[model samples]
Target: MTSKFDHTVYTLRRARLASQLGAQGVAIIPTAPEQQRNRDSNFLYRHDSYFYYLTGFTEPNATLIIFADGRTVLFCQPKDVEREIWDGYRLGPESAVQVLGVTNAYSNVLIDTEMPKFLENIPTLWYPFSIHKGLSVQIDNWLTVVQSKVRSGVSAPHRLNDVCSLIDEMRLIKDSHEIELMRTAGRISANAHIRAMQFCSTNIRNKNQIFEYHLDAELLYEFRRCGSEFPAYSSIVASGSNACVLHYRADKASINDGELVLIDAGCEYSSYAGDITRTFPANGRFSRAQRALYDVVLESQYAAVSSTRSGALFTDPHNAALRVLCKGLLDLGILKADKCGSVDDVIANKDYFPFYMHRTSHWLGMDVHDCGAYSEPNSLAQNSAPSPRVLRTGMVLTIEPGLYIRPSADVPVEYHNMGIRIEDDALVGDSACELLTRDVPVDPIEIENLMN
Candidate 1:
C-alpha cells in the first residue's frame, strides 16, 4: 500500500540524518526479518521502526544504507514472477529509486558483496545497537572485509555509534505529518473502545455468557474496520479480579454481570500507535464500589493530564497523579492515616506502591513505548545533577493513571479486587496538553448513557 505521508517526508528525514552524520559516518538500517511461526508459515511481517522512519518501506529482507553526503542506497528483494505468484508483489530494486526517492537501489542478494564497499573509508559506522539480533556480527563481518584491504589503504570505520541515539531524539518530536497520523489513530482506538463497551453491555443484558475473548474480538474487529493495520500491542481484556494483573491478556474466563472489565487496547495506523485504556461495568450500570474506585482513578488521570504541558518536567504528571491517588486512597480507607501517615507522607514513603505502582505517563509514537530518552541529555553537560526531561511542543505521551487493589486485610472490603485505569493520549502544547483519545467518554454518566 502507498504511504500516508508524501514521499518527500521520508526524503527529508534521510537528508536530516545524513546532515547529522556529516562527512565521516555511514549508517546502516535493516528492516525486520520475518519470524517463523512453526514449520513453513511466518508471522505477519512488520518493518523496523527506524528503517521505516527513514525509508517507509514495508517489505521484508530490506536494508537501507545512508551516507553523510545525503545519498541513500536501498537493498531490497528482486522481482521474481514465481515468488510473486506464490507470496505477493515485490517493489523490486529498480522501481524503488523512483518510487521511494532514494539515491540508488539494488537487490538484497548483493548485500554480502556490496556492504564492504559502503563501509570502506568511513571513519564511523552508525547503526542501532542491541535492538536487532545478530546485527552486530553482520556489521563486524562487513568491517572485517574492509580491514583485509589494509595494504591498498582502504580503512574501515574504527568507531561504532548507535544511530538510535540520533533517531530517537528526532522521533520524540512529532512533525505535522506524524501529529495528524497519531490523532487519527487515537480516534480509531477510541471508537474501538466504544464498540467493545456497547457490545459487552448488550450481551450481558441479553443473559448471554460473556467471556474476555468476546470483548477482545470486538476490539480487534473495530480496529481493522477503522482501517488500522494492527493493534498497537496485545489487547488487554481483564475482567473482575483479573484486572489486578497489570499485563493480563484476554482469556477464556467468564465475565460476571456485576464485575468491571478493563480494556487497555489501541490501534496502529500508518506506523503510528494510539494507546487507550478504559474500565467499565460488565453490566449497563456500575456498582457503588466500582464507581467509587473508578472515580478516584479518573481524577488521578485528570491531574496527570493537567500536568502535561510544554516547559513542564516529564515526571510532573506522575507526581501530580500520585498526590491525587494518595488522597483518594486515604479518604476511601484503603490506607489508614495512622499507618501510612498523611497523603504527602504516603507519597514520600511510597506506601501507595501496593495500590498504584506504574508511572502516570509514557511516550507514545511509532512503537507503543516509543524510542526516546527519558532524561534530558543536555542536563549532564550543565554540570548539575541529572534532571527529568522537559516536556516540549510536538511531544506526545500517554497519561495513564491506574489503581490496582488486590485483596488485603488492611484495605476496605469494598476496595479489594478492584483495578481501574484511565488513560488518554496527550500532545504537549505551549501552555497545556491536548487529549487525543477523548472520543471515548471517561465520565461515568456518559459511559452509562453510551452503553444504554
Candidate 2:
C-alpha cells in the first residue's frame, strides 16, 4: 500500500535523527503491537506516535532502525494474500522502500537474524524501554547474541538512552502540518458540542427526559461523520451531580430540567487530538445561581487563556486561573474569609483546591496529554531543576478551569450538586494564543439562545 505522506519528509527526519545520534549511535523504534479486544477480535491498530513520527507507517509489527550514518532501515510484515483477505493488506518491504524512502527494507521474519548485524559496532542504543513491554527482553536477547561475538572483535552497544528525550523536544513544538490537523480536529469537536446543544435545545424532546447517552451518542455520530480516528479520551457526559465526578463515564443518568450538564470530550484526527469542555444547563437556560457560577468558571478560563501566549511560563496560566477561581469562590462565600484567609493565603495554603481541584492546562497534541517534559534542562553543576518556564510559539495546550460544588454545609443550597467547567485548546503564537475551539459558544445567553 502506498503512503499519502511525502516520503522525503520522513527521510529528512530520519537524517536529522541520525545526525543527532552521532556516527556510533543506533536507534530502534517499533510500531504499536496489535492487541486483542476480545476473543478472536482485535482492536483497531494505531501506529506508535514515536514510530509514526519517523516513518509515517501505520501497519502493525514493523520496526524501524536508524543508524548514525543517516540510514533508515525497516523490517515489516510481507504481503500475504490470505491474511490480507481478513486483516488487511501489509506494506511489504519492497513497497516500504519505494513508499517510505527508507535506506533498506527486510521482512520482519529476518529481524532476529539480521538485527544483530545492524547492532554491530554501535556504542549507544536509543529505545524507550519503559514504553513497550517485552522490548527489554528482546533487546537483552539480541545483545546477548552480540555479546557472544566479542571474541570476534565486534562489540554490542554499551550505552542506553531514552529515545523519547530526543523526540519529545521535536514533538513539543507543533509543525505546520500538525497544527493544521489539530485545527481540523478542533472544528469537528466544536461542531459536536453544538450538535449536543441542539439536541438538548429541541423542545421536541423534554430536557428532563434526555439521557446523558443521548448527548454522547450525538458526539459519537458527529465524530465518525467527520472522520476522527477515535475520541481523544472517553467522552464525559456527566449530568447534574454526575458532573462533580470529574471523569464520569456512566451515561445512564437522566438530565434534569433545571440541572447543568457538563460534556468534556474531543476527537482525534490524523493521530492529533483536540480537547474541549463545555458546561451548559440541561434545559438550555441557566438559572440565577447557575449563571453566577458559570461566569466565574468562564472568567477563570479567560484568565488562563490570557497567560497561554508565547513567552509565558508553562505554570503562569495555571497560577493566573487559580487566582481568579480563588477570588470567585471567596466572593461567593463558598470559602470563608476567616478560614481561608486572604486570597494570597488561600492560594498559599491551597484552600482553593476543595472547589477547583485540577491544574488549568496541559500540553495537547498527538496524545491528549502529549509527550514533552514540563521542566527545562537542569544545569549539570547546580543540578537543580526549576519549575518549567517559557512557552514558545507552536506549543499547544488546554486552558480548563472548573468549580465542582458538591453538597456541603458551607456550600450554598442553590449551588449544591452543581459543577461547571469551561475548557479550550490554545496554540501559542508570536503575540498571542489562537483559540482552536473558538467556534463553540461559551456565553450563557448564547448557549441559551442556541438551545432555544
Candidate 3:
C-alpha cells in the first residue's frame, strides 16, 4: 500500500534509460520466473528488482521493452476466467497501456512472434546479461529469425550491450520515493530487533529455556505486525558460541542464561531493505568482559559512521572502522603485541582476519546487499586496487563493524566465544550521515534497561 510512487517516476526512469541507447536501440527486461518449490506448490513469488524499478509491475511472466524514442511496450499474462478462479487477479495486457503508461501491450505468448519483428534492422540490442536464465538462448533464436530476413533487406542488431550495467548507474542513487520507503523499513526492522531483545530477556526472567528459533519468531512477528513484507534475508539469531559463526542461521540451539545473543536481522518494506545487527546478554546484563569487547565494537561502529558523509571515498568508513578495531584489538590483547606488534603492523599484516573476517559495510537497498559498483569507473591503475567510489547524497549503506572472538587458548578465557556487532543503516547526507536504524538502542546500559 505504501508503493504510491507517482507513475511519472517510472516513465522518467524508462526515458532516461532509453536516452542512453541510440535512436534505433531496443531494451528488454523480464521479471523473475516463478519456481516450483515442491510437486504441488510454488515458492513465494517476488518480482525482479531491476524490472520492478522500471515498471513497478509485480506480476510474474512479464516483460518490459523500451525503444530509444521513448516508446514503451509491455508483455504480460493474458486474461483467463478459469485460471483467475484458482489464482489471484492479474492486470492483463488489455488494460496495461492505460494502467502502466506503456505505448503498447501484448500477451506474453506473442513474444517469440513479435520480438523478432522488433529485432529486425536494429543497430544495437540491450538486455540483462548473465542474470536471466535462458534469455541468451532466446535472444539467439530471435537473432536467427532476423538473420533469415537478410534477403528481404532486414538486418539483425550489430552491437549487444548489457542493459543491467546502464540501469545500475540509475539505481545507485535513490529517488525521493525510495528514501521514504527505506526510512519506514528501517523503523520496522529496528522495532523488530527491540522486540527480539525483550523476548529473550523475558524468557530468561521467567526461568524458561529460550531457543534461537524462539527469538527469530519474535523478530518475524514484529516485522509483519509493523507492515513489513518480509525479512530482508534469513535471520541470524546466534547465541553463545554460535555467534562466532558469521552467517549462522537461527536454529534450535538453546540460549544459555549468561550467553550473549547476536541478532542480525531486518525487514523489507515495499521492496526496500533495512539491515541492523545488535548483540546483548541473554540475562539483560552485560558481563564485565562482554561490556569491554562490546564497547570496542561499538566504538568502531561510531568511527565508521563518522566517515560515511558525502564526498568521502566508499572505503573511508571501512578504513576508519579498521583503524579503531585494530587499536581496540591491540588494547584488549586479542592480537598479541609480541606476534602482531602495533595496531598498524597488525592491520598491515591482516592479523585481525581471524576475529573480523567480513567487510565493515555494504550498499543496502532493494536487495539487502544492494546493487552498485564499489569502485570508481575506469579508475584502475597498474599494481593497485581500483579507486573506491565517492559517497554521494541519497546513497544508502550499512555501517556494521563487528568482533568475533572464537574460543582459543591464545585469547583470555573470559573473552573467549564472545561475538559483538553493532550495526545501523546510514543515509549519506551533504555534511554528515543520518543513522536510520537507531530507533533501537545500541548502548549496553540502554539495552539492559529495555530488557528489564
Candidate 4:
C-alpha cells in the first residue's frame, strides 16, 4: 500500500539528484535481494535504504534508473497471480510507474535484454559497486554488452562512476515528510522502551528481571503492538556488569538491585529507523556509584545533543562529548591523572578506550547507521579534510555516548562493573535542532518515577 509520503519522497530525491547531476549521467539503484534463511525459510525482507529513499517501493528484485536528463524508470516484478498467492502482493510494473510517478516501468525479466537499449544514448553511467557486488557485476556485463553494440559509427558512454556518493550527499538532508515519518518511528520506539521499563518494574526477581531474552522479547512485543514489524537491529538488553560490553547481545544475567541495565533498541517504520539507547537502575533506583556514572553519561549526551546544529562539523559533538567524558572519568579515578600528560593528551591517546569506545554519533535514517560521508579530505594537508563534513538542516542523527567498566580485578576498583549509555535521535534544523526521541525520559528522577 502506497502512502502519500511515498510519492513526495520519490520526487524530492529525484529532484535533488537531477539538480546535482545536471544532464550528464544516469543513476541506477537496485533493491536488496531475497536471501534464504535456511532450507525453505527466508529472512524477513528489508529494502535497500537508498532504493527505498528514492522510490519507496518495498518489493524485492527491483531496480530504479534515473537518466541524467531527469527521466526516471522503474524495473520491477510484474504482477503474477501465482507468485502473489505464494508470497504476498506486488506493486506490479504498471502501477509502479503510474502510482510512483516514474517516467517508465518494465518487468525485471527484461532487464538483461533491455538495459542496453535504455543506455543507448546516455553519456555516463552511475551505479554503486561497494554494497551490491552482484549487481555491480551485472552492470559491468550490461555495460560490456552496450559497448559491443557500438557500431564503428556509434558512440557509447565513456564515463562510469559510483552514484553512491551522489545519492548519499542528497540524503544528508531530510525533507519535512521524511522528518515526520522519523518522528512517528521515534515515538513508537520510545513507547517500546517504556514498555520494557514497565516490564522491568514488575519482574524484580533475579532471574525474571535480568533475563536478557525476556527483556528483549518484551521490547519486541511493544514494537509489534505499536505497528513496528521488527526492531531496527538486534535489541541489546545488557544488564549489570554485562552492560560493560559495548555490543553485548548475550543478554543472560541475573538482575541485582545495585546494578544498571542498558537497553539499546529501535524500531523501523517504513524504511526509516529510530535508534535510541537508555540506561536505568534495574531495581528502579540507582545506587550512588551507578547514579554517578549515569549522570556523567547523561551529561555527555546532553552536551553532545546541544552541540548539534546546522553548519557544525559532524565530529564536533564527539569531540565535545569526549572532553566531558574524560573529565568525568578522571574525577571518578578511572583514568589516572598522572598516566596521561594532560586531558588533551589523554583524549588524543584515546586512553579512555578502556571504558568509553565508539563515536558519539552517526547518521540515522533508513539504516540505523545510515549512508553518508562523515569527511572528505581537503587537498592542502596530505590527509586533512574539510574539518569533517558539516551538519546541515534536514539531517537526522543519533547522539549516543556511553561508558563501560567491567568487573575485573585489573580495573580500577571504584569504577568496576558499571555501564551507562544515553542516546537520542535529533534532527538538524535550519536554526537549531529537534530531538525526535525526546519522549523517553533520560533524567534519573523521571526514569525512577516511571519505573515506580
Candidate 5:
C-alpha cells in the first residue's frame, strides 16, 4: 500500500537539524534489516521507529544521511523487475530523491564506495552503531578506514554519541498530524478491546468454552482489519490466575466461567503505538470480590491520569497511583495494617510488588515503550532517587495501575486468583490531561453494562 506522508514535513525536519549541526558533521540513519523467520521465510518487516519518525519510508535496506551543510540524501534499493514481481514495489534511488524531496540519492550498492568520501571532510558522523550485525561490521570498516588515515593527519571526531536522545526529545511533542494519527490508532485499539469484551460475554456462556489464544487471535484480526500493520506488542490475553503472571503471553488456557480476563493489547499505526489494557469478568458480571479489586485498579489509574499535566514531575503520577493502590489493598484486607509501616512506608518498602509489578506510566509514541528521559534535576524517581527532568505539554504517556493476586490458602481467600488492570493513554495538556482512550469503559458498572 502507498504511504500517507507529507514529504515536505520530513524535509523541513531534516533541514531543522542539518542547520543546527552546521558544517562539521552529519546524522546518518539506516532502516532495519530483514531477518529470517525460519529457513527461506522472512519475518514481516517493520521499520525502525526512529527511522520512520524522521522519514516515513518503510522499505528495507535503506539509509538516510543529513549533512551538516543542510543536505539530505537517501540511499535505497535499485529497481529490479524480477525482485519487484516477487516481493512488491521498490522506491528505487532516483525516484526516492525526486518523490521524497531528498537533496541526493544513491543505490545501496554504492554506499560502501561513497561513504568514505562523504566522511573525509566531515568531522563527526551520527549513526546508530551495533544494532544490526551487518551494520555494525559496516561501521567497523568505516571507522577502521578513518583511523588508518589518521596517522596521515586525517582527523575524525573523537567522540561517538547515539542520536536516540536528540530524536526522542524531538518526538516528545506531537505535531497536529502525529496527534491525529495516534488518536485514530487509539480509537481502533479501544474498539478491539470492546470487541473482545463482547465476545467473552457470549463465548463464556458455554462452560466447556474457548482458550485465551483464540481470543487473542480474534483481537489481532480486529486490529489488522482496522488497518493496523501490526500489534504494538504481543497481546497479553491472561485468563484466570494466569493474569497474575505479568507479561504472560501464553494464551492457550481455557477461560473459566467466573474468572476475569486481563487483556493488554494495542495497535501500531504507521510507527506510533496505542496501548490499552482492560480487565473484565469472562461471565459478563463482576463478582463482589472482582468488583472490589477492579475498582481499586481503576481508581489508581484515574488518579495517575489526573496527575499528568504540564510542569508536573514524572514521578508524581506513579507516587499518587501507588498510594491509591496501597490504601485500597489495605481497606480490602488484602494487606495487613501493621505488617508494614505507613502507606508511604509500605510503598517505599516495595512490598506491593508481589501483587503490582510494573510502573504506572511510560512515554508513548513511535515505539510502544517509547524513548525519552523521564527525569529532571530535583525530581524524584518513581521507586528510586530524584530524576533530572520534568513533564511538559504535548508529551503522551500511559497511566496503568494493576493488582494481581495468586490464590493461596494463607492469603485473603476472597481476593485470591484475581488480576485487574486499567490502562489509558493520555496527553499532557496545558492545564490538564486528555484521555486518548476514554471511549473504553473502566468503571465496573460501565464495563458490566457494556458487556451485558
Candidate 6:
C-alpha cells in the first residue's frame, strides 16, 4: 500500500531556487528543532513549512545546503541501532541520497567541519537572520573561521543577505501538487464543521446541552476520521457572548437556548492547511435575531470571496466586504445614519471598528496565515499609505468576513451578544477564484435542514 515519495518534485524545487541564487552564492535552510513539552516528553514534531517546501524532508536536526552549481547536500542524523529501538527509522546518509533525491547526504557530525569549506570565497551568503538564534551564532562562527585564514589567501563572504523573503514570495503561489493537497484539506475541514452542527442538534438539543469542549471534541473526531494530520490552529469553539471576543480558545462555556456557537477551526492535510469558520444555532434552528445577523455576515462574506480573483488588489476583498457590512449595520439600526453619518463618512473615519474590526482576507497555504508581503514597499511619500500587492493566479487565500455585536448602550437589545463569521478557502484563477472549502453549507436554512 505504500508508494514512493515524489522525489522529482523536490528536485525541481531545488533547481528553481538554485537558479535564483547564482553560482557564486550559497544558501542554507534548516528544519525546526524538537521542543520539550514536559520534563521528558517532547511536543509532536512538525517540520518547518519553508524547509519542508524545499527539501520535503520532515526529520528534525536536518539542514539543506544548496549551491548555484546544481549541488545539494543534506546533513541529517545518522542511523543508530540503539536509538532506532527507542525512536523511529532514519534514512541516514547513504539511504537519504537514494530516497530523498539529494546530490549528497551526510551525518550531522560533519556539518561544522564541512560547512566552513563551503563558505570560503562565496561572495554572497544567504541566511535567515532573526529567525534561529543558534543558527545565527553558528554562521558567524563559520565566517570568523574563514576570516582567520586570511594569511593563506582564503576570503570570506563580505555580504550576508536574507533568503527567507525570497522563499516567502515563492510559497505565496501554490503549485498544482500543493493545490490538490489543500483541496483535500479543505474538504476534510468542511466535513468536520458539518459534523459539529449535527452533533449540536441531537435529542432536540437536549443531548447537546454540554460545554464548548464537547463541540471541539466533535470537530477533532471528524478531522481525525478524515485523515487530517492535525488541526492547523487551536480550535475556537465560542458560545453566546464569548463569540464576540476574537481568538477565544478557552472552550468551557455552556450552550444555552437561543444562543449561537461560533467555531473557527482548520485542519492540516499533507502539510497544507484548510481554514474554515461557521456559526450556527446551538439548537437546530436559528432565533429571529440570529437569523438576521447571520444573513448580513453571509452576504458580506460573498462580497469578499467575489473579490479574490487575479489582478485584484489585496485590499479589494476587505473594502468590498466593508461596504456590505456598513450597510448591514445601518439597516439593522446598529449604526444610525444620523449618529454615525452616511456610509461614506463611516468608512472615511473607519467607524465600523467596533462591529467589524478585522481584515477580510489573508494568504493561506502550509501555514494557516501563510507568508508573503502584503503591500508594495512604500513607493509613496512618508506620510501616505502604500498600495496593496495585486493578487496573482495560483495564489491561495482565505475570504472571511464577520460581524460581532456586543452589548452596549447604543446597540439594540435584539442584536446584542450575537456574533457571526463566514470563511472559506479560495484559489485565485485566471478570471474568478475557486472555492476549496465549499463542502459545508453556509446558509442557515441549509444547516438547519442537515441537522434535522
Query: What range of 10 consecutive residues in model 5 has the weakest lDDT sum?
Result: 375-384
> Taking the tens digit of each residue's C-alpha lDDT, what string does model 1 give over 139-248?
98998999999789998799999999999999999999999999999999999999999999999999899899999999999999989999999999999999999999
Tell me the whole-model lDDT of each prediction, alpha carbons only: 0.92, 0.87, 0.91, 0.83, 0.82, 0.87
Best by the TM-score measure = 1
Residue 154's lDDT within candidate 5 is: 80
lDDT of 3 at 312: 99
Model 1 local distance difference test score = 0.92
lDDT of 2 by residue, 124-190 (tens): 9999769898998999989999999999999889998988888888889988878999999999999
The TM-score measured for candidate 2 stands at: 0.97
Q: Which candidate leads in lDDT?
A: 1
Task: Give a tens-digit lDDT track for model 5, residues 1-452.
Answer: 26654587777777776775645777888988898999999999988777777778889998988888888888899999999999999999878876787989999999987876677657667776555567657876777777778878787655565666567677888877789889988988999898888888888775547889877887888889989989999999999898888889846898888989999999998777899999999989998888888888888887888888998987888888999999988888777777875677778898787788888889999888888777752344255775645778888989988998987665689888888888899988987899888778888888888888
Clashes of each: 0, 0, 0, 1, 8, 0
Q: What is the C-alpha RMSD of each candidate to the true structure, in Å?
A: 1.3, 1.6, 1.6, 2.3, 2.7, 1.9
Which candidate, 3 or 6, would have the higher TM-score against the true structure? 3
TM-score of each: 0.98, 0.97, 0.97, 0.94, 0.94, 0.97
Candidate 2 regions off by >4 Å?
A: 1-3, 203-208, 379-382
Off-target runs (Cα >4 Å) in candidate 5 are: 1-5, 146-155, 206-208, 377-388
Which residue pairs clash within candidate 3? none
TM-score of predicted structure 6: 0.97
